[model samples]
Target: ESAEEVIGELRPLLKGILREDKKSIPDMNEDEKIMHGCLESKPKHIDSITRAIQMTPGKALSVLLSLELKGLVRQSDGKHFSLH
Candidate 1:
């Protein structure tokens, strides 16, 4: 088969597999909740994230630290955070 034909044939199967994988992904946890509070492409202040997630500042900071250590989040100067 030509490359295009092979890709066309595989496209549906690949999409199905991706759908299954997405379904299998577990729900967000504590760190994920905090991460979700921040914008994916923009940094947000710690206070804003905390309030957005409705978490205590201390607890949000703790979870943010965990996310940072796990390489899922990046912290900029002045307590700003965004998805890494």
Candidate 2:
């Protein structure tokens, strides 16, 4: 078969695979969403996450630690946070 024909046949299969992958991802809680949004594109400092979340830096750090425990994020060099 031509490459175009092969690609056309795979299109539906690929879409199914993508949909399954989306379904396998677990839902996030509100705190997790707050942290997730702050970590978009690049890692962030404690102060930065606090600013984005509109909470105290200490409270933001607590939320970040919880997210880390949930396997949704990580802290590096004891300063920055990012998606895992």
Candidate 3:
């Protein structure tokens, strides 16, 4: 199979791992800590969130998108995000 096919096969397993990792954490995880950090202050754009969360832009967006998918955060105007 091609690389794309391999990735497609791994997608569901990766998602399951992420979900399980989210549940199994003892304390706030990097993602949750970032979420709470945003919640403590005003709503922020992705760039600001990256700075506030102290993570790379790609990593920050990934975490924020994950949160948005989980319904923990909402984005309005497709720019800013805040806790739901």
Candidate 4:
């Protein structure tokens, strides 16, 4: 198949997978903990999140990055984050 045809065929499946993933919360404890630390509408600083989640900044950053990739969180202003 041509590149466009392959992409077109995969697009719907990819979209369905992505939509299903987003509908379910991550099962990891760290992910859930950090997610709770993020405010619903107000962006919070990394330091505040770390404190609230009681995780080392490095570990929290790692979890936050994972959450960002999962489309459940958004990072802003370099060090701030909020639920997406």
Quick one: best TM-score, which candidate?
2
Compared with the true structure, what per-residue lDDT tens digits does model 3 show for residues 1-84?
Answer: 999999999999999999977844335567766565675334678777777767887877777677776767677675677876
Candidate 4 wrong stretches, greater than 4 Å: 1-22, 26-30
Residue pairs that clash (backbone atoms under 3 angstroms), model 4: none
Of 1 and 2, the candidate ahead on lDDT is 2
Of 3 and 4, the candidate ranking higher by TM-score: 4
Local accuracy of candidate 2 as per-residue lDDT tens digits, 1-84: 999999999999999999988834357778777677778546778887787778887778888778787777888885888888
C-alpha RMSD values across all candidates: 6.1, 5.3, 12.8, 8.3
Best by lDDT: 4
Off by over 4 Å in 2: 1-23
> Scored by CA lDDT, what does every candidate get?
0.77, 0.79, 0.71, 0.80
lDDT value, residue 35 of candidate 1 = 60
Return the candidate ranking by TM-score, descending.
Answer: 2, 4, 1, 3
**Deviation (Å) of 84 in candidate 4:** 0.4
Estimate the TM-score for candidate 4: 0.60
> Model 4, range 38-75, lDDT digits (tens) per residue?
65668889898888767789988888888787777888
lDDT of 3 at 76: 66
Ranking by lDDT: 4, 2, 1, 3
State residue 72's C-alpha deviation in candidate 4, in Å.
Answer: 0.1
